[model samples]
Target: MGQMRRRGTVAAGIAALVVPLTAALGGATPAQAATSCTAGVGPYQKQAEKFLGRPVDGKQSSTDCTSIRAFQSKHGITPAAGYAGSVTWGVMNLMNQQKAAGKTPNKAGTCPVNKGRIACVDLTRQLSWIQDGKKLVYGPVPVRTGRDKYETRTGLKKIYWRHKDHVSSLYDVPMPYSQFFDGGQAFHSVGVSMWNPPGSHGCVNMTKTDASKYWSLLKTGDDVFVYGRKPGT
Candidate 1:
């Protein structure tokens, strides 16, 4: 009788564990599960895929969203949460439209200088590019320029200094991958939303990824041109 009771107790315990395990297994999908973006095959997807070096199949598959997020991360888009929503689509569309119009995809009118390697900042377009004469090296990359009160100075300048890991003496903030051009202003990586309203304070903010790339492509004394006004000015 005692043996029978022990067996029954063990069976009950095993059943309880099994029941909860089964329930958990049947619960909602894991957070790491593949995410399917619903934006579908459209202009946004087409351009995004092209930008991401993916096949332009016009399908918003899980792979597409992943590639879009990768691009977002490179260009300073906030969240980089793998969703090609309004901001992502808007930027991509603008780039595509510009390309279709036979203009430099990210050029704000024209190249500020017509010479050697230069970093071009078009505040009007909130985009930056690195070019060697007329040959494009990188960009039309989304950037955040200074806000209204502390507007980024517009004119031709040159990168006079560079700091792989710099800290602002006035702002008391870290400025990584900093390349100073005008006064205390610089082009550096900032952890803020590039698409949002309130902008930076006399600085050209880029994504960490872009900043790193810029560091590699530019050197001290490289020409830096700040022109045009930011969109929605």
Candidate 2:
């Protein structure tokens, strides 16, 4: 993803997070925002793939449903079971943001190991992992990602801090590992995601259990890998 050609200035609409590319959506004609499961699905799926690092035909996985539910929970939204809905749109919006940031999932799935420790994100599969020496840890958590061309970043990153049971807004958003990248993208956990892969605003969301587990195991500068639909070998 490269610097998006903005048609207008981006505005802060939803979440406190705002980027320039989002400006295009803000000015999109009503007809453009309207999504049809037919074509709109592609943009959503494509953006998700950018994060997953592989083509995960959103229609081919139950994880898609699980991911949508997770999105609903994040924004104080309730998730419905089965089928993509309005909530899914919001998730897509987040994914689009990554593209705005010039971090779409490219073809090469190679995230360098920086300083002997690496925190990598795989956009196509929507998964994140941690590596320490030869040890690898994984979690198939829900994420609210950036849009089509705007996807979560993938590269050698680092974990700079950890927050346990951190309070966010009205929810106790627990960040297991706060990996320092651009600004505030952390690896955390929440109490949602009915077992699907929702998008994240760059931040990685783990299960409540995994958040706590990683909280104890993860350390600053430890290697982290964000790839796959689920954390795996």
Please tell me which predicted candidate would have the highest lDDT against the true structure.
Answer: 1
Which lDDT tens digits does candidate 1 get at residues 80-152? 6556666676655544433342326434447654668988887766777788877767755667788778899
TM-score of each: 0.57, 0.42
What lDDT score goes with residue 48 in model 2? 46
Q: Please list the residue runs of candidate 1 whose C-alpha ends up more than 4 Å from where it truly belongs after superposition.
A: 1-103, 106-109
What is the TM-score (0 to 1) of candidate 1? 0.57
TM-score of 2: 0.42
lDDT of 2 by residue, 1-233 (tens): 01222221111122222222224235443244333112324335544443334356665244443343333333444433323444455445544443343322322435543334344555554434444333333332234344334345555455665555454542344444343444466766655542234345556665555555556656776765544432221
Task: List the lowest-lDDT window of 10 residues for candidate 2.
Answer: 1-10
Instruction: Report clash pairs, candidate 1.
Output: 41-58, 123-229, 123-230, 124-229, 124-230
